[model samples]
Target: MSYRFVTPIPKRAATGSVAAVYSASARELGALFAPHLSPAPDLHAALWAVLRESMLAGTAPRARKEAVAAAVAVVNRCPFCVDAHAAMLHATGSHDTADAITRGEAPDPLVAWARSTRSAAPDPWPFPAAHVPEYVGTALANHFINRMVDALRPGSLLPGGVLRAPSRRAAGLALARTVRRTITPGESLALLEPGAGPAPAWAGDGPVATAWPAFERAARAGGALLGPTARAAVLEAVAGWRGEHPELGGWPGSVLGAVPEDERPGARLALLAALAPYRLTESAVAAWRSSVGPRGDAELVRVLGFGAFTAVSRLADRVAVVA
Candidate 1:
């Protein structure tokens, strides 16, 4: 559970040559998730790896995924996720689309119903339990969300109404979301924490610091990041940090400042350093950073901070999910 720092080598100039970075990163991540993998030996670890791979593959166009993710985040009352997804949606095209989504505008009748279901409004008519289970509301919301997510696949969403088949990655992320929902915040935190067992060493300070600001900018630009389960894990980490160090209460600014500059390697190594304490290896931390991109790294940190506050809020009997 102690911290150690690792140095980072600048990635090759060729943007296309992401293989080296990705491979190195995946190795480290694999180590971080090792403990969780140990108990189930088959189910948990296998599924986790598969999901991680799917995320890396970018199976669907970023825009579609963002749209659905944003919708789900909104309905779930998770501001962090909403903001993050909205940013992603904006990145793909126009600010107008992002704005409309955040404001709850539906482009068509189907979309309207989708929005309503996402908000958990009652169905227009009653149906048999077999057709609509007790959790019909949640299931409907998820279905609509899945539809949006599925639209991410190439040709799935076209101007004139062409429906392209869904990619494996799109299907995978949806499946991952479902599985992730089954895991409670406490359980995930336990899996991610350092004491669970030996994990990859921390990469360095550069990535951590670099990522913090990036996440902040992304959240400010859009709103939130990470789905419910991942968001909860972030909050749990932040709360744990605060409980041990009361002075670092707020997120981004306060939390970023908590780590001594001298102890930090550099902005490029910040993420590695930040994760080092958690026993992540250099390669693993690097991969996480690479997967997030500079902006993603920053946004993730901000989300994590918000997540921590969320956990605290819940403990105090406040709202469980932030709107």
Candidate 2:
């Protein structure tokens, strides 16, 4: 329950643009979400820039976009994410919809569609079949982000209905308006980094795979944000990963446990990101945030988020392969 699990960097200590977003997030979501943003400054900028752009990137309306996001949050049972996106949905004038959703009431069409993706036997999807890539991408992205939130951190912006309130929802819209200008889809998909694995075979040669390059770049780019020291530590931990233990959901057991001593918090964080998120504990969070360890929070979040992102998205890939 304690935010102390991950230590927040002081405003002065937070790096360049990450400091800017931290200030904005504090203004919008309260100080609660700061720790998630402050550690991995570089990753914060690169990953989010592309993701935020993607949120409004294609023709997806804010309504459908937020609906997909809210549904994903509900599916993941991430209280914070559900409220945040539901508010965004409300601000778009889907008041009854958002309110009902957060309270666990009338389900939206998009919500049903989002749920259908999980079905072993999917029905004819009712929405625009052409929007599949964008819709599925948003849902999958939230799948990754949700796991990271539920796993690595704690706390939300508001206590309860406050987050879903009309005024609060308007504020969320305002924040989105402001925050949107700051984000830029960076060169997320340039070329593979040293330690990054290419898009897995399960992704297949389909719409998701076509777009997979960008996501893969964005996912791997966050790891690049880690400073030389922290980056090395994390890579070491991932390399040392024995992959024997299965936590949250297990990852490829044959590939992990590659880090060394120095006990760099980033290394532990990376290992958890790659292999076991359910294994994340307050003690582990605190150790990474330790003064002696890595310097930034955004970098940490990006690396950790990317790890969870890759893990969760693997479900879609495997499902695609089966189909």
Candidate 3:
């Protein structure tokens, strides 16, 4: 089945601090996936940019946004996200507040009342009738899942699940796979290389040439905006490399090594994948299937995707509120 994907918006620059933050986030995220597969870093980076753009343009509070994210992770059973968000709460000195809520404890009167309201647990000992909207709870659940997705499978943020989701669990697994692939053996070596220079002739000239454009096109279709110069350079570099290495089927560590450190992470990789010429590589496809294998429920996958979307929407809203 052909999957629908969002193309990157054609723009000159990312432009704002939030946008830059999002880009950096994408890069870091991509680094997480670089080791496992050929296309993961690119996918992760592209999704990060798309989600950040959406959030910066929306109206939500960051704290509430994080709470919602926490809720989703709890429901999804994603330990990584739960621990990470809990740490975030702790850093903000809200550990007591969050922990109280999570453990079903007898919190101090004032805090207990608030936790009861937030968790929507029926009042055991009533003080005042405090009502929490069903939607609020729903939003929290959704937010949690979305954040997990953002952290784990940024690529799935693209409009359609074309490259990633064959089913809901498959989608989640696809995201997990993307995360796995972002960190690779070559990143350290790439970082140690002298002055950020263009890729070696052997690195560029090969099957990488054909694959790069396909990847780039996918990224553009998925909402990553690339400047003219950046786009042109990528195209030229990939083309030259493809001409040199006709046997290459997947991207090499050196290709990433060649990228300037500033541009070498998730966002750049996503941009490269979106603009490259190949479909999800065989390794990526296989890994995605394996990751989601244990959780066979498609509904869970849909919930995860929807949760991610909601979290991002909320984050966008919060950023707007402060701006």
Best by TM-score: 2
Off by over 4 Å in 3: 1-23, 26-42, 50-59, 104-323
Candidate 2, residues 127-243, lDDT tens digits: the string is 564555556667666666666666656446455544346554775666554333332222332321233334444333333343455556656666654445556554544444332
Q: Put the candidates in lDDT order, highest first.
A: 2, 3, 1
The lDDT, on a scale of 0 to 1, for candidate 3 is 0.32
Worst 10 residues of 2 by lDDT: 183-192
Q: What's the CA error at residue 15 for candidate 1, in Å?
A: 26
lDDT of 1 at 105: 74
| TM-score on alpha carbons, each prediction | 0.26, 0.59, 0.28
Query: What is candidate 1's TM-score against the reference?
Result: 0.26
Flag regions of model 1 displaced more than 4 Å: 1-61, 108-114, 117-323
Local accuracy of candidate 3 as per-residue lDDT tens digits, 131-192: 12211222332333333333333442222334211232233333343223222212212112
The weakest ten consecutive residues by lDDT in model 1 span: 184-193
Report clashes for each candidate as comma-separated counts.
Answer: 38, 22, 62
Q: Candidate 3, residue 47: CA error in Å?
A: 3.1
Model 2 / residue 18 / CA error / Å: 3.4
Please give the lDDT score at residue 45 for candidate 3: 36
